[model samples]
Structure formats: C-alpha cells, structure tokens
Target: MDSRLAQHLLRRLRHQAGADAIDRATGAGLLTERRFRVAGRGVRTFVPGPLAAGRSEAEIARILERHAFAGSIARDDLPGDNDPAAVPEQSAGHDRSKSLDANGLLRAVRRSAEPLGAADVAAMLLLARSITMNTMPLGEILEALRLPAPIMTITGRVAGFEKTFLDLLEQGLVLPGKVASGEGHILSRDYDIRFSHVSDARWRVVVFAGTELDPEERERTARQVSLAAQSRYPILGVSEDEDRLPAVLRQAAGINLVSGPLDLGIIRDTMRAVLGQVPEGDIPHDHASALTLADLALAIRSGTSAKRALAVLDDLARIRMALAAENENDDGAASGKDSGRKETGSKTGKNSGRGNPGSGSERIEPAVPTGTETDRFIPRVETLSGYGKAGDWALDLKEDLALWRAGSLHWEDMSTKLLLSGPPGTGKTTFAKALCNTLRVPLIATSVATWLEPGYLGDVLIRMSATFAEAEAAKPAILFVDEIDGINTRGSAGEWTTYWDQIVNRLLELLDGSARSDGVVIIGATNNPDRIDKALLRSGRLERHIVIPKPDTEALVGILRHHLKGDLDAVIATAPERETGRTDTATADSTEADTASIATGEPAAAAPRRNEPAE
Candidate 1:
C-alpha cells in the first residue's frame, strides 16, 4: 500500500480500462511491476497484501477500490480519457469550474433518469457534491425527488421591461428574440448555457420551453417569478421622479436573488434584505453562478460584514413549557392561554422578527442530511443500566452523568478524560458502552489493531485519522479506543521505532483537546495500562483511571442469571460454594488456573474497593 505500488496498480486499472498510453508505457516497464511469490503464484506488484495471491482482474479491482477508500490510491491515478462519463471529472485536486460546462453537466444529470427538483439546479451549476447529492459526480438517480425554493423573478412594467427576458435567454431558457434594427444584437453558441447582457431593448422574447417543466405550468410559473422581480425593482424608480418604490422590504431567509446590476439603491437594498449578506449554502446548480455573482455584488454594495446563521433554533415546546410553569406559579393558570402567545417561526423563510410579510419559502437543514447511515451515531436502548456494579463508584458516575446531560456544568467537570483498564473480557469495553449509555450519546469505537490492517505505516495513519474524524463529526458522543496497548512505545528499539513514534504523536495530538470541538469524551481501554506511553496517561489526558476486575462470585451469579434467562435462583443461591475459585473471564480456564486462585482472594476484593476512594 505504499505510494509507488499504489500508483502502479492504479496504472494497471487504467490500462484495463483501455488507456492505450498507459498500456503502452506499462508494457515498456515505465511502470515496473514488482512480484511477490505467494502461495506458488508470483502475485504482481501493486496487489493489496490480502489479494497478493489473487490472479484475477476482478480481485485486483476490489483491492484497488479498497486502497482508494483507505486514501492510498488517489482518484487522480485513475484514467479519464477512456470513458470520461464513467470517471467523473470531479476528483482529487480537480476543480469543477475549469472542466465543467453546462452541456456535459446537464447530460450527466439527465442520464440519472430521476425526476429533477428545485435544489438540483445549484448542484448542477457548480458541479459540486453534498449529502443531498449522494453518489455524485455520478449524478442523482432517484424517484419522487422534491426540492423547495423554485427560483423566479419579475419586473414592474409588464411587457415593456425586456431586460428581464435577457436573463432567461442567456440561461438557455429562451431563443434569441426576433426583431429588426431596433431589436437587440443576438449572440448564439452551441454551448449548453451561458450568461451575458443583450444590447437590443425592443427584442421579441421566446422561452426555449424545455420538457424539464410541464407544458402548461412551465410558462405560467416562469412568468410569475419573472414579472414579480421586475415589478418590485423599477429600473427608473430611484433618483428620477419615476414610480414610487416601497420604503422598506422585509428580510426573508431562503430567498436567493440573481446577481447583477442594481440600477437603484432601493433595488440593491431590497435584494440584500431578502438574500442577506452571507448568501447561505449551495444554490441550485442552474443558478449557483448567478447567485454567487449576486452575493459578490451585494458584499461590495453593503458595508456590513456577514456571518453564517446556522445555529440551533430554540425549541417551541421548551419555551412554552417554561412560560406555562411561570404563569401557573403566578396564579394565572386559568387565563394564561389567552395572554401567553408563543411564536415558533420556520427556520427558512419566516422569522420571529416583524417585517412586511408574504408566503415564505420553507427551509431544511442542508448539511449532515437526515436518513443517512452517519446521521444517528448513538446506539443504546432506553433500558440501559446494570452494566456497572451496584456500589458508590457506579452511583458517582450516575450522579455526574445526570448533571452533564442536563447542562448544569461544564462537561469537563464530569471527568472529560478517563481511562478504563482491566483484564481482557472483564467488561472494559462494556464499561465504555455503558458510559455512553449513561450520558445518552453515540459510541464511536476504533482500535489500534484495526488501524494496522493496511499493513503500511501511512495507510494505518490515514485509517487512524479517518476514525478520529468520524468521532469528531458525530458530536456529543464518546470515542472509545480499544486495545490501546498496541500503540505502546515502551519496547520499540528497531527501524519501526520512528514509525510507532509518529502514530503515538498523532494519537496524543487528537486526545490533547487540540483536535476536539464538540462535546466529545474519549475513553481509552487496555488490559496492560502499564505498557502505555507515560505521556498519554499524564494529567490533561487520560489521567483518571478505573480498574475493572474479574467478575467475582456474586457478580458471576448475576451474569449467569442475566444470560441464561432460565431458572438461575439455584445458581445464585449455590454461587457462594464456588468462592474457592472464580475466573477473570467466564472461561478463564484458557488462562493459568493460578490466576483463578489469586483473583478469588484479596486482589479481586481490593480492585473494586480501590475504585471507590478514587471516585
């Protein structure tokens, strides 16, 4: 999985994809092949370790895909000439604005065979991908797709204001207006869509009228959105004693204005009022360019700076509940409903602030889309308890956990950093899960063993980074790094010492509070805590330690009853007889019987008791 080997394999894939130049160069040994003699077959160079013995193209492709996912074989390594359609132009280091033209973009989107929507226009225009634009660059191939905020604009003078028609014509909406000498000079090209100003003022307007919209409704909705914009912004209204304009325009979210010339100050201010200075998130593909230009124009006009406004909205129910409680305390319970009016406006169009009102566009959260695999990271049933033993230690955890969840104090007050160390299978991992359950957060677990799977230093480092990134993205969660002992730097005195040093450094950086932004708590679990780097276990890191001992005689009986689901009263009652010996794991017979003897005595009793004083 080294860079050179990954490149070689990628070249092979490109060659198989019918890249004549790559095939010729590969045959010429420009991309030399290294051979690994595995299982009586000389597996060619660039083959993933698991598939080193694989001789089939399909197997090699699968391994190559895995490497691509692991961030080793980059997207640039793939050939684009063979089938540019199959290999999307958007990839590593590829800027869409350079390669993307409207024709190819429209063709790619239409190939998806999905009913398109309002939201798709912005994605199409920019050639950008997002959570909504899933499997993209490939295109969105879905059914029953719906999008909010259909774009439209209008003018004051109904038929005379030909300036509005130019926007449509340039967008490929209308053909060149037919007129004589007084008509506008027409600029036509076979390119899919382009935007510019037309010179002719008295030109005939003919909308291209594509099948994207239904015949009847298409022209009608277009007219509505178009004429309204013109009517609102009278070109000759300002400075000259022309038509009088409204003194103020109400600001509504989600209403994006097309960027261009603002002839009058009122028109400029009106556009700013609706669209705001921030410009919000992605515009529909068809309109992203126009909207971007529009934002730049507004930014230049307005002296005010813009800030992103996508913070958490207050819950209406919570506000009502608090209001209701206060009214009841003041002896106004019977008449509270008449005077207590709560306004929970939509996040997109309507605002709690008062202004001129009309029907507003509905808004939805654009990023981290719902119904995706990564949406809900938390994993626990409502009934999540009994993982911890019945004692002051467990009670203390519960007490702080409640305060932490209720936002009563800074999360750091509840031990943001903690270490859970114990013998294998002694509920170390279980405690990690239980901790998340106690806090009602998601559990994102990764291990040093899993990171080493790629069998390359850089590949493992990439995996580690990706895992941490996942935990970071899912907020208010717990990150559990299991088998952390694999990262031990104690006995490393070889060529790999420098390699291990990098990994330990990266791990420390992530857990050092330098990388975390969310309410994320990290828990590191290991059987041999003594083997871990002392730097990692120091204060401001995993400084708080909890040692989980082997399930004792009493705990073992409880475990048996829970698992059996049958009559375990007999087992619990007679469990005291087995006090002569108990295993760390239920099947501790796998370990030396001496551990059973030692665990049955003072060590088992002392570990649980020591945890109490630490708490």
Candidate 2:
C-alpha cells in the first residue's frame, strides 16, 4: 500500500469496526498479507491482514480499534495494502453547524432583546430564524411565536414580569382575543397576525432601550450584540431610532421597542414597513354612468370587460333604433296617402288597398285561417278554454315568461335545443305557439306523429339533418318540435338508437352553429325530458334545463282573469255558496238569466230554475 493510501484507509476506519473495515478492504483487493500486532495496557498480541492508517491522530485511534492493530506503525513502513472502498467519514459536526448557521438561530436571539431569558429568546429566535431561512411569511412566524407558554415564560424571565403577561395577549392590538372558558379560566389564548406583505431583502433592526440611557451606551450595546450574532449565525441586525428607523429598516427584520409609547409608535412604524415604494407615473381618470337593468343583465351574460359589456349594451340599443325607424316610416306613409286622397278627390276608407281602390267592395277576406296549410302563414288567435285543472296551467306559463323577460332566470338561448315537458293538455303546445306569436318569429311547428316515417335508418337521419339545415337558413325562426321525446325515447333498439343519436347530434350541431349565426331559435317541446337522452343537456348545447313547474295560487288567478273575463269577485263568492246549496234563489236566478241571454242572444222573459247552479 502507498503511505498516503494507508493514511486514507485509517481515516475511513474511524466510523467502521474491524470486521466491516476488513470486509471492505478485502472486497477492494487492498489486503494481500494477513499479519498485524496489538499493544495496549502492557499487553502485546499479533493478528493477521493489512494495517490501516489515518490522516489524523483521532482517525488512527479509530482504525486501531477496528483491526486490533494497537501497535504503532512508523512512517518508514512502506505501503502494505490499500482498499478503494476505504473512504474517510465526512464531518457530521460540520454539517450540523452548517444547518444551524443557515437557519440563523443565534442571530435571531441577539436581535430580540438583551438580558432576554434563554427559553423565551430561544422560542422567538427559532420562529424568526425559521421565517428568515425557510422563507416563511410574517403571518406564520407570528403565529408560531405567539404560543402563550413560551411567550409568558420568556417575558416573565426577562422583564421580571408576572404571569399577567397572559392578559396582554388578550388585547386585540397585539393579537386576536380569546373566548373565555368555564369558571373564568382561559381555555386558550391564541394570537393571529396578518402580514400585509413581506420585504424581499433583510430588514434593519432598531432596539430602543430607553430615552434616559445615554446615546453612546445604546450604540455600544447595539453594535456589540449585532456583531456577535452575525459572526455566530447567518442573519444580521442593526439598531435604529424613530427618526432614522424607516430609512435603516426599509427592508429589514422586525424591531423591538423597549420604552416608547407603543401604540402610536407601532402604528407609524408599520406604515413605513412597505415592501417597496411605488414610482410616480401618469394616471388616467375616466368616469362612466351606471348601467340600466337591461344593460346590467347583458353585461353579466357576456362577462366581457367593462368596455366590451358597454359595447354589447350599445348593440342592444340598435334594436330600439330600428323600431323607431319603422314607426316613423309608417307615420309618413299614412300622411302621404291622406294627402293623395284629397288631391284625387276620392274618399278614403281604412280598407283601401294600396293599388286597387275598390278591392274591398268586391269580397270580404276570410278570417285568418288556423290549422290550414298556406304559403304565407299568419298565426291565428285561438281562444284559450279551461277545463277542471287546465285553467291554472296558463299561469305557470305566464310566470316563466315574466322570468325570461326580467332576466331573473333567462330562457335557454334562442339556439338551444329545449325540451318542455309536462302532462298533456297542460298547454305545452299552446305555450310554444304563443311564444312564437309573441316574438313575431316564424314558427316551424313539427309533431313527432307527422315526422316519423316507415323508412330506412339513413332516410330518417337525412330528414332530421335537413330539418335543422332548413331552420338555420330561415334565420330568426323557431323550429318548434312537439312531443320530441316520442322520436327519441329508449327501448327502441338498433336503428332507433342510431337514428335518435343522429337526430340529437344534428340538433346539437345546429344549436352550436346557430348560436353564432344571427336570429335562429329551436324550441323543442316534449312531455318527458326524463325519457329524452342525457347527451342533450350539456352546456353550450341545449344548456338551459327549465323545469316548467305546475302553477301556484297567484299564477292560477292570473290565468283565470286573462281567459275567463268573468267577474272574479262574484265567482269566488258564489263558488262556496253554490257548492253548499246556500246561494239565494234571487242571485241564482239572475246568474242563469244572464247565461241564457249570452247564449241565446235574447232578453230573459223568466227567472232560472231555483235548483239549477251557475257555472
């Protein structure tokens, strides 16, 4: 072994026992011979194998214990055997020292307070060090250091203050207050500190001992403590006074004040404790008016920036502009026609056709045809009739309409593939027609009974796709499909799924496409949304899931008033009286007489039968 190699082997043996070191040495082929001697306590012995040497005296002693090589080897002894595996044990003490230095534990204590009790200072020091080294934010550090046991113990020990220091912790200024427990004993006193911001650089520390203390004494103490801490640990602190505090502590650690009026000084100190100062720059000031309800609603829906939301409101305003223009045009045309009639010396009637003067005298136009196939279709005004429960149904429809207009609850987008489900004769179909009429848009009302055909699956898909395409081309129109669930229900296997899936897919595609296109809506009315497939309810696709709930009392009353045109007070009063047979004959006779007069178009000659009741 080389002499230097032997020394390295000995240094490696300090952390390992004899057998382990020999195993390592043998594995490395460093040991060729097997002979060694041991001499300690006036005893001499000889063993086998190679001897180990160390770089230092301590390592040499460890190596002797490992191989029982108690006898000393001289520098004259040539290299015996060297193992590649034999490596020195690195210093554990140095690594531990590095960790403590990195944590800045010692520096934190010296900066806190002199004559500070070891335990209290230790707790604060650990907390501050953890915050500084670990990059813990100020809030967390304050919480860890606010533990009552450590704080009170340290304060009592350092300031000779009593346990009443716990009371100081209760004041919200220092920390948040604690709730009292049973028998007037505090269950817990935990302080919560909120950090506004943390500085990027180390802060300068300023300790105020007292005004009476000479300035020289304060400076000496501060410098001595600061230097000692920085030398021992990774952190550094400096002392400062109020006038010089902000500039010195601009971005430094916390300061401890010993003798000033705490509240005012602390507030001013905190105000100066900003992360950094903002640079002066040009600032713009622009003011705008508050939005109206309609504008506000559009703003929320678009979720655009304030300026863009305002732009959307501007677009909606154009709708009102167009309406005003149309009104003005109508007025001008009426005036022009009236002037022409006076010039031509012909009397004008309301029915005068634009080109033909006497066309109205030839024949009367038929009442707007309902349920008839015509090229130019106009919606017929249907008289809504009510049955036992149907009268209350219309009210629900009105409530939903109100909700839609108010935007309290918005309707599905005009392009949404909606499913309006309810029991039959609940006005699902009528409501659909009414919406189309009210909006004055073309309604392509198709029924499942009419659309389904006995044909190939391809034919069905083609027809379904064509329907959506045509609806899209006819922009500003509603493709009102009634009983939609009929064509898309479960249990019809094979071609049914294929056909229905294609239909749903086509509907979703059209809905998505039309959402970007102007003025097309698809209103699908069904009696069973549950029976409809689940894929249609996804967002941005038939996104609105409106459950047309049954009518409540208020809604029912509105429906009755709108359609019946009957005396509500009389109906309500007479309802119970007639049911109980307590209605007087005079009132009953007058009601029957009025009904007969309405029905027959004749004056009533006699009173009604006493037994009969008015409906």
Candidate 3:
C-alpha cells in the first residue's frame, strides 16, 4: 500500500480509538523514531516493534467501519486468525475473551478529547456515504434534501462544521490535536466516542429531519452554516442548489383551497368581505318625473342650441316615465299580495281610480302631442364658430366665408370642392364649423365611419341626397366631412374592386351635385391629402386646396396666450428676433397705409395679407 494511504488510514484509526488510552496502554514502550547507519554507507529509519504491534490491521479496519469511516481503511490486508502475533510483547495484556477489545483505542481517543454530537456525526456520515458513491457535489445533496436553490450562500457561526467541532471540544467531547510552533496540527485531530453502538439508521433520520424545512427557511439556515464555516475554512460560499420553484406547495399551511361550486350565498359573503354591511334606508326611493312641455320650453331658452337641448330633455323624460311605470307596477304587485284575495274587476277599478285621478276615465296624453311646433321653435339651421386653433385659421379664411355669405359661391355653378388638409388637432373641424357659422347656415358633418354602415350602401346615397336637399333648402350651408382620407384613400386591388370603388363613386356623385350654382361648399378635411381621390380634386369640384401648417412663433405665442392665460412678458423675452422682425415689418406697413388712407380721408380698401400658411 502507498505510505500516504497507510498514514491516512492510521490517522483515521487513531481518531476512532482514544489516543490517550493507546498511549497509556503502551506506556513508555511506545515507538520513537530511530536512525541507524547500515554498512557504514546509508542511514535508515524505523518505528520500535512494541508500538508497531499495538493493533492489527484487521482491528483497525473494524474500528473505522464501525464509525462509518471504512473508506479510508481496508479489512482484507489483516493477518489470518490462526497466525501468531508478530510482536508478542504488544499483545501482552490482550483480552481474547471479548468479541472486540477497543478499550485501549477508546481510552486513547478520549484522552485526545475530540467530541462529536449526534447531529454532527449524522451529517459527517451522510457526507461520507454520499462521497463513497461518488456523489459528493452540493447540487446532488440539495436535490436529496428537496430544497430550492439558495439565493445566497449559507453562512453563520452556530450551524457550520468547524464551529460544531469546536463546540464539541468545549463540551469535553474532543481534545486538542498535536501542537507545533504554536499552531495545532489539524491532521492529528480525532473525535472521542461515548457510545459504541451508534446506528446508521438513527443518524440518517436525524439528518433527514434537519434538512426538511421551508425553502426560505432553509436558505436562512444555509447562510448561518456558511458564516460558521468561514471562521475555520477558507471556503468561497457559493449556492449549489437549483433555483426552480416547485409547481405545487404540497406542504404549505394556512391557505384555503376552493375547488367546489359557488352560489349566491358565497357571492353575498364575498361582497360583505369586500364592501361591508348595507345600512337601512340607503336604497333609492324617490325619483323626479319626466320633463313636461314647460320644462322643455325653459331649457330651450337657456342658451343651449334649441334642437339639441330639446333632444336631451326628451330623452330624460322618456327615461323618467319608464322608471315611474316600473315603480307603479312594483307597488301594485305588493298591494295585491298584501290583500290576500283575488282581485275583482270592480275592486281593481276602484283602486285604479283612487290611485290615479283620471285613470280608466281618461287617457294620459304626452306633454307634446306633436313635435312639429317644438321643431319650428328650434332652429333647423344652426352654426357655432370662433373656437380652438381652427378659429384662428378661420380669421384668415374669412374671404372664402364672405363669398358663400354673399351668395357669390353658388353650389350648382361652382366646379371646385374645398380641401382643408392639415395636422391633427390643429382644428380642422373647428374651421369647418366656423365657416358654417359665418355663412349663417347649419353644417352637415359626415365622416367615413358614419357613411360605411353595414348594409347601408343604398342608405348612404339616400342620406347624401337628403343632405344636399337640406343644404339647398337651407342654402349657403357647409357640408364638412372630417377625416376625408378615411373614405377616399387609395387601396389594394381587392378593396378597390369591392368597398372602396362603391364608396368613392357615391362620394364623387355627391360632391358633383353639391358643388353647383346653389351656394353649398363641400369642405373635406384630411391630415393626408395625398390619399384623397383624384376625381374629387378635379376642377369644378374640390379644386381649392388649402394647406394648414404649424403656426409661426407669433401665432404660436398668441395661441398659447389664448389657451393658457400666461404672462406675455416671459414669452416676449424668449421670442426669436426673426419673428420680431416679421412682426415689425408688418406693423410698419400697416401704419404707413393707415396714415396714407387717413391723409386722403378714405379708409384703406384692403388689409395687408399674411404670407404664412393658415393654420
């Protein structure tokens, strides 16, 4: 056998034995190193015969196997049972009467005073057993323990191997190893055993119990162990367990598992948990009746646009009447049930007559028998203007508005349609409304979504015709279709062959009819003008294209002041010089023209126009 292996086995055997007892058993007869010259040429070293014959190899192997450290020792190399002792003086006090005599060895180990507890012994055995099977890696150990990988290293003083061993020594279970140069020789260390029959099963059970714990709790314990280990061993604490979470928390406690049907009782209980108790008399009981004709009249005079205002009033009235009827039915049902008798016709008549003054004798007519008079009071044509960014653009758009207002831009004779294309939110819709307001005519606003209703192809044409008829009746009206590109965009062949072609054809026909001698302007607003149908932009249709761009700094400042009520001084301070120059030049020209016109005693015929695009 290799000398190193022999030495390691000898150390392990000594650990199993009691080193002090071994020394006492041998007394001063124990071996000492001796060097002697051989043939006057070489020197040789040897241990004396008495110490060498202290224990047979078989006895050593048996002791190691009993302690579960057999891997470091081998049993087959022992001398046969029949063979006589090689050194008889070492076996002088041998007791052949006992099956195994470890008294000397035990005494020696006890003298060394190396102590190990049940838990430590178990852990060591488990490590040894696993290593014997070539599975010493911590990953496999954690798998056996059924733990999620630690997020951090296990550490601490109380739970680690070195601390546990130190604790054993303090408890008189271990004695200090050999010391040299003021440091203990770790290789000479050995554990003292108090019991001879330590069962592997008992040790395994203890280890299993220690390892079985909640994952988070296990991680905490591991960290404590690592801290303990670091005090003695130069170990880099790295997690070795896998990080995967378990699919089912089979051992989890304190959570309710619901796997059955839920009914109204469960729902009520859940609501109670979430919303708490309902108070008495919290339920709604009173409600206002529908708006009468008098109420509608009052609302119409309240500055709300008459038609829209009436529509709102009518809707509210209908809802109130429906609710009142439902309440009446509920009351009747409760009264009938309380009476506890079949309701006769005479009794019902009497009850109904008492409940309602004119019941059964007269009809309850709605407040308005006909909406015609209400319609007359409401303006058939109405317009709103001067709002948002579009209103600012409309100030510049006044010339176009004037032509329609003067009846010079008749719908039937005109060939060009109006294209108001601009960036979104810059008030395209507002400009369209302003134009209608300036013309003193109602707007017929339509967009692609409104026109493209399912199964409404024919209805679209009819609606278009009706709109034109309304505009002609109410002449000088603006027909504004916001997001015009949505309806008239270029598309793939399939779309062009199907929905697009039909929609475009209808729109073109409507544009042609509307852009005629009778004053009606077909104003189409789009962010993407390039997507509009070419035919619609042809002369005598929507030929006039007005592009609205971002406002200049002066215009922007003016818009900001209008929208946000900010201090103009701060804006003026930060205003670019180029914009100031333009403003100055315009003001100078206006002043010169004003002076000239005043000297001549006639007002200026024309105002100076801005070169910037309207936005």
- Candidate lDDT scores, in order, read 0.38, 0.36, 0.39
**Model 1: residues >4 Å from true position, as ranges?**
1-398, 514-518, 566-615
- lDDT, model 2, position 120: 23
lDDT tens per residue, model 2, 1-615: 112332332222222233344443333232323444456334322222233322222333233334333223233332332631233346533221222221132222112211112222122222222222222334655564444211110111111111122222222112233212111111112322221122332221112222222433444444433332332122212111222222222223342221111111111111122111111111110001111223324432312343444355445445544664686566667767867532222322111211111101011112344565441233222333222222233344445555655777555432234556666656666665655554544555665544455243323433343344344434345676777776564445575675555455555554565566544456566768787756666665555545555665434443454444445446545643343555576777666655444333344546646666544
Candidate 3: which stretches are off by over 4 Å? 1-416, 463-470, 488-496, 565-615
Clashes (backbone N, CA, C under 3 Å), per candidate, total 24, 14, 45
Report the lDDT tens digits of candidate 3 across residue range 479-589.
Answer: 676677876543544645555665676567556555443556577889999888888788777787877776653344334444432344464455444344555666655
Give residue 538's error in model 1 in angstroms: 1.0
Instruction: Compute the lDDT for candidate 1.
Output: 0.38
Q: What number of backbone clashes does candidate 3 have, counting pairs of residues 3 or more apart or in separate chains?
A: 45
Residue 529 deviation, candidate 2, in Å? 1.1
Model 1 sits at a Cα RMSD from the real structure of 27.5
- Expressed as tens digits, the lDDT of each residue in 349-407 for candidate 1 is 11221111110111111123257644323322222223443223444655776676688
Worst 10 residues of 2 by lDDT: 355-364
